[model samples]
Target: MKLLVVFALTLAYASASVLHGFNSLEDDTNVGIIHGHNAAPGQFPYQVQLISPEGLQCGGSLISHRWILTAASCTEHFDNVTVHLGSIRRSAPRVTYIVSKKDIIIHEDFNRYTVSADISLIRIPYVKYSIHIKAVKLPKIKRSYPSYDGCNANITGWGRTSFDSTHEPEILQYAKVGIISIKDCKKKFGKLGKYIWPSLICASIVSAETWEGDTGIPLVELRSSVQIGISSVDSPKPELEYPAIFTRVTSYLKWIKRHTKLPL
Candidate 1:
């Protein structure tokens, strides 16, 4: 029996208006850093910031020189999409890349209501590799990485630090989280468990305040460079600190290979 409470979760969409607010650290002071810490420069080079005229909307990963992996929900509507690369701080120094809507590809099986097949890809022109920007390793198709309890993992994004706060961090932030087995994850939501698609993976977060703008943040396995999941959904009440939902990348290995020319 899923609870009837839904917190006002904000997507990590960073619009030009909100961009100004993120730049103000003073505002962030009171908001409290509920979870996650500042990410080191180039620590997660494959990480990319997805931006629309709306501002910073979602997070994405560079799978190849010309391809980015993100959530289909982020590109639902054809809009001008810009990507920022090689920067830990969104408010300052970095290389930026932009692509057109025609280049965005959402999986054909994508279901908006269920958020199934939530994955999407952005095809950009070939970009030269740099220390701050590189493609992330996808898990081996024949081999599956551990997703058991206490499996090491980390997630990075510029979303709000606290569940109730509207302030997004000016710098990139990352947090270590544990993987929750699907069965255990399902039990957390009771009735809501029915909505949990098998294609999605779940992770345990100390603070579940996932905002709308964090739609496509990458959930990378810490030990190896493998990116295992993409931020997909969260519990209705983020303040309650529920497990975070992600689109399991391993399940779509074939689909990703078919779409992008990654050396998968």
Candidate 2:
């Protein structure tokens, strides 16, 4: 099945990095553009947790006052979830938090294979809470698509230090890289003969690598920082000295608006 293929490929990409044991992004310099304070500096900004029937501690992005975007795979089914806010260092106890919430929205046509539409938004039913967190802006919806050569793009993840190597990082980790042409990346990966969708963006560094646990991470653009691309899947070819793939946020604004419900 297409769904199974997508899920399997993604699992491979996330598992290649050892530090995370299972969930990891295969490269080290997972890229992004910070809209707020630097994440590594502490980032209680939105204390993110991934909870599923198996366990908790998935991955998420601190995007807005009441929303944290993350992998739809990690949120499809949940018992209880929480989001922590407004601390540079999540290790501190003075952070803000919201518990006993559910996944408020998810992309409909989300294909787990290409990792397209992997984005999801979680909302705290109640407003007043802990940390000084504000909503990170969403990208403007467009009937048009732009190339990476002219757009700002990057990805972020709080995954482990190494691929399947050790414990997950104590603090969130982020990196910055630009989006490249999917045609170039697939061609380099020797898969151009295959399928690279219009929704996917390719990225790489001439001299570095990305790792696991970084899947579902945000690949951001500098112009607005709000114009984001999400890293939903990765390819594992020897050609990828440094390779990355992301889901373009601007392309999905319509889906986001449809799913998000504001207070009455």
Candidate 3:
């Protein structure tokens, strides 16, 4: 699959380009994984590093014994993928799982232009249970306990340290973000506002950095510990404090259930 994915500032960029402060380059593709403080090992047991022969490409979450959740843009053209789990440090993974291209599933209605339904799932088939790595708790379908509006959440990944930097961090990094309404996000996004769909989730970070390679990372609700969103877009500004977009997890419940037999 030649996934022609690009977004932010100019739609001509590649998968996760540096937003805000830098000029768009030809070779810089991947989502944002910037500005967050380092996370302790096992702090996020559900987190996984999506890797190809080129090294760390994206971040994902362990959703079930045999399933991993991430962005469709990340899995594109990748036939041989290795998932690193049970560790916060990607350089020294405790457990690694392999998956073929046939096992990958991208949302059928996904729009590469608007990045709608940007979610994807990787079928592991046989994941051994362990304390170091586990499935994340999902929010109930009709539950309103965790309000999507202005809720506190987190984003973690091993993306770039800065927009100009080319290296991915060895240790995982995380930052706190607040869920913002689509209306507010639209106002902040300006010309790019029209592309914000109802199916997507919007969030704001005051001073945190989330850049390329951070795509597909989970946005866990602080109070409920349930993953409500997946990292999708970073603001196209240099400040890196603009509202970021996420693929709403609650919107894809049926699609997720259809692929995995988990009681989700």
Question: Which candidate number maximizes TM-score?
Answer: 3
What lDDT score goes with residue 98 in model 3? 83
In TM-score terms, candidate 2 sits at 0.71
lDDT per prediction? Answer: 0.69, 0.50, 0.73
Report the Cα RMSD per candidate: 5.4, 5.7, 4.9
The best candidate by lDDT is 3
Candidate 1: global Cα-lDDT? 0.69
A best-first ranking of the candidates according to their lDDT comes to 3, 1, 2
Q: Estimate TM-scores for all models.
A: 0.83, 0.71, 0.86
TM-score, prediction 1: 0.83
Instruction: Tell me how many clashing residue pairs each candidate has.
Output: 17, 47, 13
Candidate 3's C-alpha runs over 4 A off are: 1-12, 16-33, 143-147, 239-241
- How many Å off is the CA of 12 in candidate 1? 15
